[model samples]
Target: MKKNEVPQDGDNLVKGESNWLNYAVDQNGEYVQEISVGWEPENIALEQAWEVVNEKVEEARTKVLGGQLSPIAFYMEVNIMDIPLLANYMDKYQWQVRRHLQPDIFKQLSEETLDKYAYVFKISRTELMNVPTNKNTK
Candidate 1:
């Protein structure tokens, strides 16, 4: 696309407060960089993606609160991590992490085990032991 043809449909993402560096062909048929407010298609796609993320967070919250899964599961969703990633961070096997996500197993964990999980999740041991009542915050 030409430099002048760079999309400026609207700046929904940043509300006109930020600009993105974009490259396009100048009138001389040379590549040039320009600032763009935003592109509508990209903005819409991001909005949809965030909606899906929020849905996952909400589902995790529900499962944790209902005792169907441990707070580890909810924290995993919040951190955008999977069992393998959490296991890698905790220096444990995937089966161990998966087992930890079971509320029964989680409740029986030692302080040392819980502390490791808290450290990886960047939360206090208390916070790791309990799920927040609200999804966004306590």
Candidate 2:
């Protein structure tokens, strides 16, 4: 597909779980089973799997959002000056580079951590990408 082509709404996985636990009666007022409670993972791999699944899901979401805004999006190249030069550097540049920071902040803040300090703010997609740069580093 071309870059500027309009996208058809594909099948989107409506994200999130349903509240299957809370239950009562439907048409006939009957007692329903309470939400089943499950014990925590007994091993390491099971716990790690959950974390990995969540990470991939969030990454997919970011990709979709990035695609939708790509036409109007501008990406800025950032070189962190404070990062000490690594002795094992192999790339052409020695400084740390970054393109996105909002996602970084979001990832850093857990659901609980973010809830404590979270404040809503309005921002355009351009602002999220740092508004791009015209100057060449070279």
Candidate 3:
């Protein structure tokens, strides 16, 4: 693609900022780095990916509310993390993190443990403890 051919079709992911890096051919017939506002295909792909993420998060939320899983599961889905990754962040073993995903085990967690999770998720302890009741709440 030529530098001048780079798409700037307007729908930016970050409000008004355009920070997508792309490579294109310059007038000199050499490769050049270009900054694009966005591309239609890339935007569509990202939208689809977010839709999947939202679906998973919703599924986890329902499970938590039904006592099938813990709020940790919901937040874990929201943060796009699996047990192993979450355990790495919490400095815990995968088995221990998996146990915390249980509703009963979550209920028995101490303030210190909850605080550590909240820190990883960048949310308040209260937010970490409570799963959003609806999509709007999230």
Candidate 4:
């Protein structure tokens, strides 16, 4: 796969407007909400989702703190099983991920100029949030 080519999986992996979905792990595994964002992007949905998740995590931290933002470490476990296509794209062509998302330009993601991509996963926040701090620590 080349850098410019899009993945093989068809579009429409996620439907409708750009929004955030929540799923609880311990419960019956139901979708909690679809928090809609005012802006939309055809292919940068994951970036948007990451920003939203980061925002919520910050809010949680703020509540935990005395209403002040603090730098806390966290992990995000995205099940790429569903979005295999996007995963492949990232693996094959995403230079940032290739270099472990290092360097200023990759961290900024300013080079992601393409459009019209899709995500096969559910794109939920709770799942992403629980990844780093889950009880499976070694």
Question: How high is each candidate's TM-score?
Answer: 0.85, 0.20, 0.86, 0.22
lDDT of 3 by residue, 16-126 (tens): 475688899999999999989877787788778988888999999999999999999999998999998999999999999999999899999999999999999999999
- Descending-lDDT candidate ranking: 3, 1, 4, 2
* Best-performing candidate as measured by lDDT: 3
Please list all clashing residue pairs in model 3, or write none if there are none: none
Give the range of the ten consecutive residues with the poorest summed lDDT in model 4.
68-77
CA lDDT, candidate 4, residue 49:
73
* Model with the higher TM-score, candidate 1 or 2: 1
Candidate 4 TM-score versus the reference: 0.22
- Per residue, candidate 2 scores C-alpha lDDT tens digits across 1-138 of 222221222221312221234344544555554442221332244457656655543443454356532211122112111112211221213222221124554344344423322211123433433322332211
Over 17-108, each residue of candidate 4 has an lDDT whose tens digit, in order, gives 43543332324444344343222343467567756665655444443234221111122123322223443654545433333222233223
Candidate 1 collision pairs: none
The positional error of residue 15 in candidate 1, measured at the CA in angstroms, is 5.2
Instruction: Say which candidate scores most in TM-score.
Output: 3
- Model 1 agreement with the true structure over 1-138: per-residue lDDT tens digits: 999999886655567865789999998999999988888888888778877877887898899999999999988888878889999999999999999989999999999999999999899999998888885682
When superposed on Cα atoms, how far off is each prediction in RMSD?
A: 2.2, 20.9, 2.0, 20.0
